[model samples]
Target: MRFLVIFLLIAKIYADDHELHSKHHIYKELSHLDLTKEQQHRVKKILKIYRKELKEYKELEEDIEDKRKDIFLQKSFDLEKINSLNQQLDREAHGIENRFLQKMHFVLTPQQRKKFVHYFDDWEVE
Candidate 1:
């Protein structure tokens, strides 16, 4: 049916968007690390968990955006409702990211943690 087709298309688009987000963060983090084989294996395992969390976060964000778009497209749009939903999505995403960072910090040594922090600082300024 036409409705089914449209639903499938939208699902695929959202899935691709999530994949892109996960890949971008993974590549960025990996680029910053100088990992030995063992370290690389550990990092990969950590990243696997992070990526799953990120994918869920991304899906939540996409759902929020879709809802906002639907509201705006209606004749009687509620900006306040959309804003509240967006804020909730933002908070949830931030919480997930913070948890991931905490896990990553726990896994790294003091020196590695400093290196990770320095990498992010440098990355931000560049």
Candidate 2:
């Protein structure tokens, strides 16, 4: 029983590691970049800022969902409010992504920047 428990624990740990290293696509790409200590620190800082924005986005998502529900359930439908909420969602999404990408590019060196661009096929430095 002891041996079985130990084996299961090790397997679980390995599974978690694989999930983090393999399943997290961005982290896997970042590991390939070979960042220096300062570069890593700067990248972490950039990610921190991104996380804050992401939190806001999550909250905004909840609000949007509630707004959608409230709109649909109302006795009188309001198309204008729905349109306004959609526009706000679009603007926030674009702003968060553009801001994060720019700051991330700024922290990386020229070579790292090239790698980042290459790794993220959709994103260009220009």
Candidate 3:
């Protein structure tokens, strides 16, 4: 059904988000940037804050998976509720990313920031 497709899409998006959000993973990404000691400290601080915020997201993502399974397994369901939850989840996810980027950019110097553009680009999964 159409609802099932939408649910699967939401699940897929969150799964991708979780994969991209690995705490140790970003450290590997920054290893090539040749960061200074201070830069490394700032990055670790930012990552710690981001990880703290992510705890709530993990619970919400789990809830999403559960709701998605419910939709597939249950005969009676409210499509409107599912759509609303999806929108809410999307907003929360984007908000966290936006905040993280802003703080991350604030931490980097202008020169370091120049390299950040390229680093961010290459961070995309193929």
Assess every candidate by TM-score: 0.61, 0.66, 0.62
Residue 40 displacement in candidate 1 (angstroms)? 4.2
Q: Which ten residues in a row have the lowest lDDT in candidate 3?
A: 2-11
In terms of lDDT, which candidate is stronger, 1 or 3?
3
Clashing pairs in 3: none
- TM-score of model 1 vs. true structure: 0.61
lDDT of each: 0.60, 0.63, 0.62
Model 2: what TM-score?
0.66
Please give, for residues 29-99, the per-residue lDDT of candidate 3 as tens digits: 56556676677667766756555556566678779878877886878887887887788778876776678
Top lDDT hit: 2
Which candidate do you rate higher for lDDT, 2 or 3? Answer: 2
Q: What ranges in model 1 sit over 4 Å off?
A: 1-41, 121-126
Per-residue lDDT over 1-126 for candidate 2, one digit per residue giving the tens place of the 0 to 100 score: 432343333233334444343234334437667777666656656655655665577689789989989998999999999999988887886787798788877777788777777746332111
Residue-level lDDT tens digits of model 1 in 1-126: 432343333333335446555444444555555555566555556655655665576678778889999999999989899889978887876676577677767767777787788644322100
RMSD, candidate 3, Å: 9.3
Worst 10 residues of 1 by lDDT: 2-11
